[model samples]
Target: MTNDSSRASGNQVSWQKRLQDNFDKYIRLVLTLANNSSQASGNEITWQKRLQYKFDNFMSKGGMSVFLALVSVFITAFAVMTTARYVVERFFPNGPTKGTDDLLWEIFVQLIGLRDTGDEANFAAKFVGVITIFMGLVLFSSLVAFITQQFESRLELLRKGKSLVVEENHTLILGFGDRVVDIIKELVLANESESDAVVVILADKDKEEMDDFLRNNIAELKTTRVVTRNGPIANLSNLDKVGVKVAKSIIILNDSKSSDNEQFKTLSDARVVKGILAVVAANGEENLPPIIVELHSEQYRRLAQNIAPGAVTTLNEADILARILVQTSRSVGLARVYLNLVGFEGNEFYFYRSKSGWNNITFGQLPFHLLQAVPLGIRHGDGTLTLKTNKDYKLSKDDEAIVLAGDDSTIEFFPEPVVQHNRIGCVERNQTLELETENYLIIGWNSKTAIALEEYAKSVVKDSQVNLAVEVLTDEIKAEFENIAKAYPHIKMEVMQVNMDSLDQLKTLKPYKFNSISILAGSGENAEEIDAKTLTILLELRQFFKEYSAATKTKVTTNLIAEIIDSQNTDLVIKAGVKDFLLTNQFVSKILAQVSQEPDVMSIYEDLFSLDGSELYIKPIWLYFPANQIGKLTFADCILAAQNRDEVCIGVRISSQAQIKNKNFGIYLAPTLDKDFILTVYDALITLADDQN
Candidate 1:
């Protein structure tokens, strides 16, 4: 490390020394030009040269020519119009005299007016007035029009998004991120019902850049007109420019690109909060729209909420992604289910007030009552959500049942028969205590590492051990681990320093022995680089598993899950038999986008994501199937069986080792109620029940 004096010596430089090094010759040349110009021209500048230089200087100012030309045209038009009015008055005294005010206004508007002047004209005076009007209009009107166009074009360049946005009750997105195009696409799907729905995005990026990015990504927007404005998201002027006050909902994207850096992420989060505050202030403590702001850290969620009390909601990306990873690491295809629900392109979460004489029934009877939708939970009028409602919980008329359906309009129940099971086969037995030791290898680290470890530890057995491997464990990383250890003592954490770039070193770890392997996205200068490193690590893991299995003469099997930053890179790691790919920003962005469309959906998101709440689980068929009931059972029987145990059977997961795109993953969500739902011993039933772990 350099001493303060040495650092000062390196930084400080006198102006004379700086000029002598690189700029002295150029400065002396300029000075010589000025001196020679003065001396050669009798030691004084000529009047013509002075005037020409002043005119050129004046012309160099932006819009100065347009201003001067408009002024000149205005003076010329005034002289021409005034002379025409005088000529008409003097030449035709008998002509009908109009007031000066009326005459001046008529002359000013006649330059661009389309109305015929023949009807108001009479003879020579009228003809002279019309001729004078034509002359001025022909010359000055064209000049003025050209000047106006040029000025407007200049203003359009400098004053970004200067036009007043007239959209009302539209969704407003306050920032731009890699997920913006996805959000816009989802909004387009959401706006398919209405012809005039608009999604106005206000970001710090250039308007043309945003528009081009969206156009390049999304081929067709259908009915949605997405308007982009380039300005500071936290600025009140920009908020008004995008019509935030009249917006129906707002999504504050934490587009803080460096999400791994704590200080930078927090600074970006502060900007989001400031933007929310500006919107709330603009709404005037009145009917503020539902604002969904994305914060990078959970510690700032409440801080943002306090900034704007009512209707201001926040989602912590790290915390939410950590929970999702922990949950999906155990159950394959569960992340797909979440992605489908949160994204508007597929079957999604819908809330409906049961008005068909079923409001007085218990929630357990909900599935049989709904059409093709399954009742996942209910929300009270007071804004409380019981996502996994108890079987005996009776819903009132004011309460709305949250259903997993194809569309919001299709949430009604159909009058169909609940097919009974013909033959009850033997079901699998349940294992109460998981005393078997499980090993987990966690590779790489990010802002979510500590939270993910804590959540993962909470879901694992008491003696379960976690082998953490990273390139370097700094004091900060150690501190994060200490915090996790203090929170979760059941998890035995071990740290290993290894170079992940070397495939041989990755093989030395023997990742297949672990019950599950998590390769987190490495934090670098940008998300693309981070994703590249993550992809590299994923390939190494793939090769490690393949070579190990080849050398040992065994079939390859391991629960591999990794975090992907960029959505475009998901395909690169898909062939590696990874159980789940957690596209962190894409999922959160979709949720925020979906919530912006329907504020009530936030409750569904909350109920589905909360850790302590009743969550969806992929329990082994042996755990749910009774001793006498197994094999090919109807989905209705599956539901009935789970209902008997006070649980809701949403779907089934058949293939344990499968990629996401493969329907062979055999994870059927919202399957037909009466269809034959075959449950093999290796398959698991996806049910909405208590967190069995």
Candidate 2:
């Protein structure tokens, strides 16, 4: 019995020693992982283990990562405490008060140390309890410190942004708003030519949430690496996180959401101005990278330029969109022309050094030399973009010809003569004098609706009429419309409040009489309702046009245009035989996308769209090409004829049902400079010329 007792005691002692060794090793392991960034030696570093190594490395780094490190420490301490108590109870069964696992509770509850409840064996409990109590206190204290530091680190990170970025020549996009996805997509396309491209986004949004949103929107981003930081982008201190100094370019978008109130919008614009100031200040005198900002008002845009001399290219996105809407409203294919000019997929503008053979040649003779490219303007050595310069204006040796070509590589001197290649026909030109009282009808209300109306008002003659009929709108929108009306006293403005869906209301307002009808995607609480309303109005208008044509026994040629929300729904409109529709919001996205790719492209658009310069026009084919002519007239013939008229003929738009897909919304841009096609009576020449020209 004595031998058995000795053996049992020896067994208990052996097991206790083993448990102590394991507990000590566990403590060492936990502390090693918490303190070290590398994996323990002799351990298999699987992908998971490698991930842990990376995670620990990240935690060791400065910024929010430090919080995770402290969290690791806290978790390790808790694990150590739990394991220690469990080991002590299992091995020291006799040393405890009873079979119940209550010693751990006592270790936690005990203030000073541990004591035994039973009087028979208080010594054993004292010896075992002292060491356990001390271990728990040390671990608990360390854990408390870790918890405190962890939260402190997190709060500090939230107050500031993440760590300073190390990227060089990266595009910095400030202010994440409605066009964020579109901007990113454009940047991605811009970077397609490069092997490695980086785009950093700094916005007043959660970084993780931004990441999730991007991932959701862009299922798979190709070569470009996108990084996001959470903080107020306009804040000067937060700007450093995006490495503004090394940025290739910085784009500041309007931050105000569509749902934001008028007061909030003003604040958002103020933030944009402040953000531009911050960027300029951050990079003092180091030749500040090209900064692009979108402000609402011309007053603010001019102010922004004054604030940052030669550094800011202020764009009024809403106003520019308003102009495009107005232009496209009257000209059927103007939207597609703008889209082609801005997108990277097709022909883009490139600045080319004038070839030696074409030296001292007149601008009129420029198109004959390069068969593939169409010269848009002369970008002088000093970078002055002169669009639609005088035909007699001679090209200087230092002139950089602005030629529209397929791509940068595709730009070269084509030796082939640019002549017409296809059989063509000519039709009688319908020549007329000044337009008779343009009656414009707008259906729906957007923030840009008033701007569109104001733009439209500028083109019409005195005593022209404008009718606005919207289903629903805010007081602010109405006030803006009224304000615009006051500016144009000659143009009679009329507002009709009625449900557009009601056929009787639609009948009361005869849309057929109007020279132009602009049906913007109707405003609604949701996109579905907006699209539904637009479709309904579109269908209703089609029915009215059909009926009006049948009753009058005359062809109704009222110019029709509609704004669509989704590009996919364009098919529905196409099926309805209403060929002209535009994605207005998407247009902004696409233009921003194009500009983000090549900043110089912005100059091309600026010149094309500016009111004081040459603009796109859908002039009749006979205006340049004489009527009663047979056989195909080549692009060269069109170019020479347009040059005579102080215009540049880029493409032709023919009324053909068979060539819908090939046509860019009824306009074709940069069709092989030599390619020729038959011209019909309804065909129009897409020209870039001043209105007076």
Candidate 3:
């Protein structure tokens, strides 16, 4: 039993030893496999997972993602390279070192699984890295292009609101002055029928003045869009602002309130003309329309004509005013009548074939044929005003019929020829009733004063008394009037030596309330004080005279002529209620300016002022006779009327409403074929003629 126990114990010990050895070996083997597997898996995941993480980062962050991805790829390649190089060097340290190309090829071959060893695997990793780098570079290039485009789009929206472009068919007036208002009024009437008309005024004056004038006087123009631009006519750049290149018609107004001196007027006019020429040249003649210029000096009209060959140049001052005074003075409605003769509305002078119905008709028979219209006169081949020409003056084919008709004038002839009515005898005054004239007070003096005095003398009746009141500032004037007083013994002339500035002294001259008093310029004074004093004295005289001549036909004519060193004073002077405030400086300035353009108008002016067949006379046309027609009548007809009765038809004014139907109608000139030209009460004036009776 002792022997058996010992053997069993030995066996157990042996078995235990064997079991312990096996367990130890097994544990070691298991640990080695786990470590190897973990290492291999970690290596594979390190390259691939790291590359994926970098790629994700590159996508999220535009620029940084590319860098991090590249870094990750390079690190993976290096790791593989290090392992392969170690294996190659350890295995074959003495062997020849491979060239860069051969090694790269081997790496590519290993990555594709065609080569053996870690060196080839390392090269394969590098090849994969190259492909990843190329992809990242492509992404970065696309990102840069997109970013640049976005930046460029933002810059394009900031450059589209400051250019000036004009529209078509605009009326362009090159200068602004007093005449501007008149012209604008005419244009307003002319354009009343059109769809749209734009008037553009180019002036050197302040825009406010132009705007205010237009607003106050031409409220109708506001709807039409009147544009006022600050521009000098002398400069092409300024002219462009007025859209002269696209203008329909340009009327060059000679400035009214320029320097009174003729030389200054000429200089300014020349400059304006030259500027107009330059603008026309630049715009090209074919594109430009008609250009009308105003001339004050009739002598300089040729010069103006030369500037714009076909343009109508008129002596604005001498022609317009002289006609007004000469015609309106004697004839009651002559001014109104004259306006119709030339105006576009109501009645106008027109010419037609005489054979229509007037071919065989005599002057007397014309009234019968033209029952609706009156045969006022006829135009012979030679222009003459033959009022008493035989009713049987043989009518010919070449003769043009001149007749006056209203809108309702009938074209049908009368049923029977009526005998001419006998004229009524005139009631002659018993003994030529002497016209009574009280003391005439003439205050302050000017060039116009002399002419006015001459006119006043001619206008005054024979037994009229006169007096001269002078603010004697110098010995020369005092002596000149004293000698004149001696010559006119029939009239008492009083010379006052008092301070015109002092209101008290002015009141002492009680003669201001005379039947006819004309306060002219203030002496030895600046324009402002002169204008102020003149206005004050005139106002006071108006009030005082109105009281004195309580039941008399008293006429007070004041002169606001030479006081215009500044044009702004016109408002104040006009407000004083002076009936005839002759603005001499304004008138003279306009005259000098106009004449500088057209010099030949002087003779026309002389004819206008004279009291003969050529004078400015308003003759009353007998439209009741049914043959004296003013509408569509020729100028030759007007001359014939004047020849018989010593009168002339110069201008015509028509009612505003009628102007619309006659679209091209204007107050300044007669229409070619207006059928409604009838003579009103104020058509023409009669001057002294040779008494044929």
Q: Model 1, 1-693: lDDT tens per residue?
A: 469877777667564577676687888899999999878988677899999998788767856675685667666776787677767677676357777786666666565444335565667545655755676667666676767888779678645655668889899998887878778878888889997889998888887777778888889989989888888887888888788888989888886753457788888887887887788777776778889888876667888888667688877777777778777776666777677667787777777785565646678776776646778887788888886678898878788777777777776664343444443542322433254666777887776677778777777888788778888888888877877776767778877778998887787787888877888877777778888888778878887777878889987667788888777676776775566778876787788888886777876666667678788777677666654466778776677666655677877677643453767356677766777765677777778877663
lDDT of 2 at 447: 59
Please state the error at residue 212 of candidate 3 in Å. Answer: 5.4
Q: After superposition, how far is residue 392 of candidate 2 from its true place, in Å?
A: 0.9
The most accurate candidate by lDDT is: 1
Instruction: Report the C-alpha lDDT of model 2 over 1-693, residue by residue, as the tens digit.
Output: 999999999999999999999999999999888767454444546898889889878967764576455556545644555565556556654453444356446554442334333354345455555555565466556556767876887776744558677899988888775467767776776678888899898988877778777887775568899988877876776787689888888888886533334576677778888888888888875668888877765777888888877677776666676677777767766766776776665677888974554556788777777777888888887878898877788877788888887767766664444454222332222332355677889887765678778877888788988889877656866788789899999999887776886988987888888877888765455545666778888888888889888998977777667777654466786776564567654666666666654667677786776566889888777665556762377776677666666788887777673237655556666766667777775777788888822
Per-residue alpha-carbon lDDT of candidate 3 for residues 112-184, written as tens digits (9 for 90 to 100): 3444454444454444445434444554455566657645543331111011327567767777765565456
Off by over 4 Å in 3: 1-171, 205-213, 222-225, 236-249, 256-267, 279-290, 297-299, 306-310, 318-357, 360-535, 547-693
On TM-score, the leading prediction is 1
Residue 269 in candidate 1, Cα distance off native in Å: 1.7
By TM-score rank, best first, the candidates go 1, 2, 3
Ranking by lDDT: 1, 2, 3
TM-score of each predicted structure versus truth: 0.78, 0.71, 0.48
Better of 2 and 3 by lDDT: 2
